[model samples]
Target: MVNFKGIGEIIKILNMNYSKKNYAIDVSGRGKATPPPLQHLLDPINKIVHSQRCATVTLPCILKAPLPKNYKVRWSKVEPAEYMEVVILITNGAHHKTYGPLGSRVRLRHSHRYDASLTISNVALEDEGRYRCQLINGLEDESLTLVLELDGVVFPYQTNYGRYKFNYFEAKQACQRQDSRLATYGQLYKAWTEGLDWCNAGWVMEGTVHYPIINSREPCGGRLLLPGVRSYGAKNKSKDRFDAFCFSSAVKGRVYFIRGHLNFKEAIQACQKDRATIAKVGQLYAAWKFSKLDHCDGGWLEDGSVRYPIITPRTGCGGLPDPGVRSFGFPSKLRKKYGVYCFSVK
Candidate 1:
């Protein structure tokens, strides 16, 4: 459990106003900076912090100095390739301020006077990325970078355009539309270890197409290769076409079926009538995995595709013996009628 004795200290720190005119500190300039073990702080050997969704995660920043004053600790989310960053918080010993979405959920751990660590609550998928914690004290400014990874589930995704129809960019956009992101090789491997068996190759984060196989089959890879993730190697992001393995974490909302014989437009209206919205593909997957949502009847998802989650497989339910989401591909928007899955963010 996190120590909350410093609540008054946190309120006191964040309440103090330290405007730019009074506390103008440049964190970008690292001229001739010595490699860490910074003189003021020390970081962990492995800077990767892993946690689950909706959990609190701490990015450690141990201070070596004795409650140093006139020094500000700045935390920012570093973008890929270091091209951009969004500030999360900044505190100059007394004054503190927060910024951006992450900032709204972040606070200084402040377990002790010497602890300058940052804690983020209600962690979400968007918070998975690189973050930098910097200590600015005149020319002695130094920083440390940490990567936040969430343990989650991975599923293969494809659009109505059919298999092998999406390029890298389009595949990513499709995953985002479904409330997920392109799964990295590590995430895919983790899913494979937990019994993810698929025959079709899909796009991973490294711009490669691969598929996880648990059973050796004649149709998939000729049964010659052992049961593992078969790879197609790296391909052109713009030219190569394939399905995608999307990664998603836990859901904070409820996904339920709104029984109705409705088209795509009607499905949308049905969800809106319930004061909710159509459930995204990823949200449905999360609900099935985390909440054990099981339904035999096919329902319209947000992407105009009909699907159903079956936790206890039986006869006549998609006619298969797998406990997973059964998809019917993308059907006609105006002609098809099905029950709609609505997501209520409560």
Candidate 2:
């Protein structure tokens, strides 16, 4: 029986009425008998268990990679197994925060083999950065650090229906359709600083409106002003409609251009026929930036834009002297005739 001396602390009482051979506990002043060793259930020392399979790390450990759905990263074990609880900590360049399933985006497995592990789902640009798991053992705190890197590209995105047609949620969904997500402010700024020039404003991850400007002409911001990213901060997320600025990690895949002049539907079908999906604008950008791929002919990217990337500046390519990604804006899906780019994951 437990004596209710106070509410904060629990006092266990053994049942004197029970036989010597039979182990029983009096659970509370109610006079009810329960199993033996009830004291261990509330024992602070018994709360945490050490992993038997893996050796504990002497120093902090790190695991870094781009993770897709259903992928898991194993965590390291902590020394001095005298802690009350284990906590997983995540830190970006800006701040440090704890991770839990209740309020945070990350979920802790609480399982340990060789070591402990943390698992995450629906990983976004905001989710990438640094992480560490801490053991809050009695009288001592220990931790191991990890760095997660996502290798992907960032670009602007808009719905096929039209420009400024998506709300914040819809914008994210549209990016997902293109194998991407609404770009974070940092990501959009990175793209802009890297010379991603677009005339149209788009919805970024923070529900704000922005656009990258480079060599700002009258149509953009202005040739007179120093080229930079323009912004419309903190608009109504639910009511406002806009395009999306998206970011995508590099996939383990190959991107190639399909042959023949085909309309949008036909272009998509050609890729499907070859067991590939039509490449997204960000994927195209990634291919160009990372692979140095150059094609003389402008082709259809996933966003319905006919564009081509030129790595080596030469004559006869779009009749442009500069080496860059040239765009043909969003064209009519039924009437536009152009080749399409396709991506296949290995």
lDDT on C-alpha atoms for all candidate structures: 0.81, 0.59
Best by lDDT: 1
Instruction: Show model 2 residue runs off by greater than 4 Å.
Output: 1-132, 138-151, 221-225, 319-322
User: What local lDDT does model 1 show for residue 145?
Assistant: 69
**lDDT tens string, model 1, 270-309?**
9999999999999998898888999988899988899999
Cα misplacement distance, residue 7 of candidate 1 (Å): 42
RMSD of each: 9.6, 16.4
Report the CA-based lDDT of candidate 1 relative to the real structure.
0.81
* Clash count for each candidate, listed in order shown: 0, 10
- Please state the error at residue 228 of candidate 1 in Å: 1.7
Candidate 1 weakest lDDT stretch, 10 residues: 24-33
| Predicted candidate 2 versus true structure: per-residue lDDT over 235-286, tens digit per residue | 8888998888887765556788887879889989999999999987767776
Candidate 1 local Cα displacement, residue 64, angstroms: 3.0
